[model samples]
Target: MGETNDVTALVAEVEEQERELVLTRFTHDDAWQLGCLLVELAVERRLAVTVDVRKGPQQVFHAALEGTTPDNDSWVQRKVRVVERFGASSFLTGLRARAKGQDFNAQHQLPLQEFAAHGGAFPVRVAGVGIVGVVTVSGLPQAEDHALVVEALRIHAAGGA
Candidate 1:
């Protein structure tokens, strides 16, 4: 029961985040700023992670902090695919799948190597345009990866650095 309630609350929080973090507009400059901010935050916290921001298939910004490997980049790609395919945060997609007692891979029929439902990728939704791209981080625990992206998004959306 406690686990269920926790999942319910987390789902609500993520949903609210999705609604509230909508950008007025997303440009190349915006992606750069957001990606740099994520790097700054990770650096301040000494987090060794890789950050990526993309507008559609074009990557606007990407950085891999020290201690991250090529595997992190692969994770970012997989998680980004999840956001692109599901139109939601990868974490949220996984949570919803788990809540429904469904296997994400079995339900979605997406290859595990190409699409990961793990946290860290978030849709870059514009106020009028909907999801134009994704911001993703890798190299941390799943929830931590998701939280890092969310924190960066919250700061970016609020015009804070």
Candidate 2:
């Protein structure tokens, strides 16, 4: 919840973060590494969630942590759909719409049944290429979910475990 300008700034910041946080190479190993990092972070924080890394429609890695349910998995799908459709982070997409005094469903005429502009999913971009996948977390507050994924991506981008 922010002012219009704040939301606009958030979208810009996320876009810059995504633009800079690209992988030199993205293999199955990279996906596994990123996915595992999300799970580990969630566990350490006692968060009940589902984390998924997917290439297009193919899930590369996924885990439902303790206390998570099937509903969280559905959230992952919804959030990822926003990222896939917009080619941006779900949080950013949501913020952009909000800044325009609209939501994705109302502004874009997208179905809420099919898409969610939640803040948990981010595009997985590879250097010199465009977004090839999405990494998502669900079950926490939207900002927390988004932060967890972004932090993991940052660590991965910096070549950390």
Candidate 3:
């Protein structure tokens, strides 16, 4: 079915993004760089956006571009919760739940007030270790949100500065 294929492709994309977007080491400096890149890309795209990078409970870098509201910040929090809980991209969590014919909320029982399975948050994975932090962007369409994060991470991984 079309929906099945779409889910499959989405899952593939999530996996590919995870595979390619890796950090040798994630530090406060790296978080700042990634967050600034997210803001720059959002500005270039004319998108009202908020970016958050966190290592556990410590906030590393956070920014809200022009046109973004407090709600965008809230979404960033929620989406990052998804990445924190799932150890995967928020988009992947949603797509995997859909593929299983279950709603993410129903399956996870995580409060909507604190968690979202929307796109734009990715686990900050370090090679040979695991997820160390999260990088999140909010205020775009779900797919576009996911794409923007992936692109920024790709650039960061490729030594863009």
What TM-score fits each model? Answer: 0.96, 0.95, 0.95
lDDT score for residue 79 of model 2: 92
Local distance difference test, each candidate: 0.92, 0.89, 0.88
Clashes of each: 0, 0, 0
Highest lDDT: which candidate? Answer: 1
| lDDT tens digits by residue: candidate 3, 1-161 | 89989898989878887888878988888888988998898888799888888876689999988888999989998998888878899999999999888889889888887888989898998999899999888988888988998888889888894
Using lDDT, rank the candidates from best to worst: 1, 2, 3
- Tell me model 2's lDDT, rounded to 2 decimals: 0.89
Collision pairs in model 3? none
lDDT by residue (1-161, candidate 1, tens digit) is 88778888888888998998898888999999999999999999999999999998899999999999999999999999899888999999988887777878889898889999999999999988899989999999999999999998888888885
Clashing pairs in 1: none
lDDT of 2 by residue, 9-98 (tens): 887888898887788878888899999999888889899999999976789999999899999888899999999988999988988888
Q: What's the C-alpha lDDT at position 120 in model 2?
A: 94
Better of 1 and 2 by TM-score: 1
